[model samples]
Target: MGRALAGAVVAAAVAVATLTGCSLRIEEASCGGGEYPVLAVNSGGGDCVPDGEEPAQGWARYPEGKVPEKVGDEWDIYWSTHTLDENGEIIELPEGG
Candidate 1:
């Protein structure tokens, strides 16, 4: 009994350590009928942001209609509808958008 318990404890510890190396957050959004697409929020990715003098809010659209992309499986894209409008125009609501 003692040996079995020790083995179980060691197995649990190893499992936890192996899983601790990565983050497992569940983002709240769906794109292309799947979880949120991976977006470079405020140029936070390790890669350098493109040359742009001003910051603008825009969603990262998929290249095509592919659903099982990296963004859906691995990363998540997040956005808020309240993003500022530049033109100050009354935009009509998009149907089922």
Candidate 2:
């Protein structure tokens, strides 16, 4: 009886840990009010614009191959020190980036 109870407790603990770990991953940021998010070109900045509205000056859509859909995702991290030029080429940010 003691061994069975210990085994059950261990199983429960493992299940809880697995569930907690799954929930701990960072989720994508949300843009409410029907607005979508955009990142600035040549800088580590971002904004949320109304749906169907174009990005404001200095702000642009992320490139096709490097769009960041989740907060702290791979592309999100990459864009921290990189940006697109007027010609849409990726370039390293200048000093103080």
The parts of candidate 1 lying over 4 Å away from their true place are 22-97
| Clash count per candidate | 0, 0
Q: In candidate 2, residue 85 scores what lDDT?
A: 78
Residue-level error in angstroms, candidate 1, position 36: 56
Model 1: weakest 10-residue lDDT segment is 75-84
- Give the per-residue lDDT of model 2 (tens digit) for 4-73: 9999998888789798884335576635658876777777677788989999889888777776766788
Tens-digit per-residue lDDT, 1-42, candidate 1: 999999999888778867887444565334334233433332
lDDT for model 2, on a 0 to 1 scale?
A: 0.78
Q: What are the root-mean-square deviations of the candidates from the true structure over C-alphas?
A: 13.0, 6.2
lDDT score, candidate 1, position 65: 42
Against the reference, the lDDT scores of all candidates come to 0.37, 0.78
